[model samples]
Target: MGVQDLLKNLLDWVANLGFWGPAAFIIIYNLATILFVPGSLLTLGAGVVFGVFWGSIYVSIGSVIGATFAFLIGRYFARDWVAKKLENHEQFKAIDQAVGQEGWKIVGLTRLSPIFPFNLLNYAFGLTNVSLKDYFLASWIGMLPGTILYVYVGSLIGSLAQLGMGERSRTSVEWLFYGMGLIVTVIVTIYITKIAQNALNQKIK
Candidate 1:
């Protein structure tokens, strides 16, 4: 089956679970993330299924747990393999070493801007010297803003889909609120990304 079909089927199954649906989806989505699922897609699913507040909460919990699990897998199980690969990668080597020197700040910056693939970086950081506590803390905090923004967008999209675009936007308030939210999210994301870029540059140097 196509990927979208597979994803929809999975969501449908999860929804059939009733009161436990959100919990089930949280676990499934967390695993999906570590398996290299596009976070944006899963995030939108969260928003669609749970609305903004619950979606954000569930995503936050699931993301933190999944990231920690991925980090541990990298640190304890895959370090040797990952290390061998990094031996030939100067940029990655630089990041590993810089993470050693810069600690959680490096972790925070990467989580914010994500120079590396999200799934890979989770495992990659496992080989670094940063402590699990620091890594988890920084990751949770760094991932927060982006998570909320995506979930909120998902909620908005859900509203549009349910109400129909024509009906929803027939009034100016809905359009205005969504427009303002989009603008704010874009501005915040840009600002944070610029900071992360600077942080990465400094760490590289």
Candidate 2:
């Protein structure tokens, strides 16, 4: 089948699962992060289907769980092999040194911004000396704001779609509200990251 047909079939399957379908999808999507699927897509989809509040919660939880799992896999199963394979590469060594010195900070920064890919971090962090508790806590806290923002944006888009095209021009105020919301989200994320970094540094020292 064509890509559109495949997507439709998947959507149908998701619809059949009802509320549980989205939750399941979020979980599975997170679990498969190593496959290079952007977790934001799942969060956005959740928001589109379930509204902002529930969608944000679902994505946050799924991300935490998936990240934890990936960390564990990296710690126990993949670290040695990966290190051996990449040992000759200077860039890889630099990353390793950076993680060793400030793993939590690196993870936190990456999570807060869209700079590095989340899936890669999930696996790469495992190769570091960061404790499981530290990894999970940092991952959850760092990822929360972005997850919420994307989910809420998805919810807004869904509302707009439901209202149809003509309503968009008529609902200029609503669009303004969304723009304001986006601005607020960006500010909040930056503030939260700063606070988190300070707290992490204190703890590390």
Candidate 3:
């Protein structure tokens, strides 16, 4: 099934479980990360089902937990394999050393940068000296803004889906307002992340 269908079915099944439903969704989202699923979709799904406030909360929790789990998996189970693969990787070597001096800042930048590989970075951090607590905190903070932006967009789409666009039809000015808002949000977010990434690269160099 497509992601939306899968999420819709999961939502329906979990809804019948009463108070356990939201918690179950969060757990599922967390576990899905381990499988290398597109967590952005899950975050968007959360916003669709839970609205912006709760969606951001759950996504944050799940993301941090999932990343930490990935870190541990690399540290204990796959360290040897990861090490060998990264042995000749100069970028990997640079990040490792950068993490040594910058700690959470580097981690935070990695989280913000769109070009950074998410799952691999989680594992890569494990080989660094950065503490788990530090990693979690930085990842949480750095990931939050983008999470909010995505969740907000999802919530808007969800609202439109449910309300038939309501007082905001296709020809309405509100549609234009929302369209511009999304475009601006995405551009600003990308710009900021790129700036931060450039600064980080310079620092590491």
**What local distance difference test score does each model get?**
0.72, 0.65, 0.72
Full-model lDDT, candidate 2: 0.65
Q: What is the per-residue lDDT of model 2 for residues 71-114, given as tens digits with 9 covering 90 to 100? A: 77777888886567556754334444555666676567557655
Give lDDT: candidate 1, residue 107: 79
**Model 2: colliding residue pairs:** none
lDDT of 1 by residue, 1-205 (tens): 8665566666667656889988888898779767767676667667777888998998888888888888998888887876785678655565665675678886776666534567777888898889999999998998887787777766766532242223333336445555765675465455545554666787699
Candidate 3 per-residue C-alpha lDDT over 140-194 given as tens digits, one digit per residue, 9 for 90 to 100: 8978877877677667666323422234334344355457556754654455455
RMSD of candidate 2 to the truth, in angstroms, is 7.0
Worst 10 residues of 3 by lDDT: 160-169
Runs of candidate 3 exceeding 4 Å displacement: 2-8, 85-90, 159-205
Candidate 2 TM-score to native: 0.67
**Whole-model lDDT, candidate 3?**
0.72
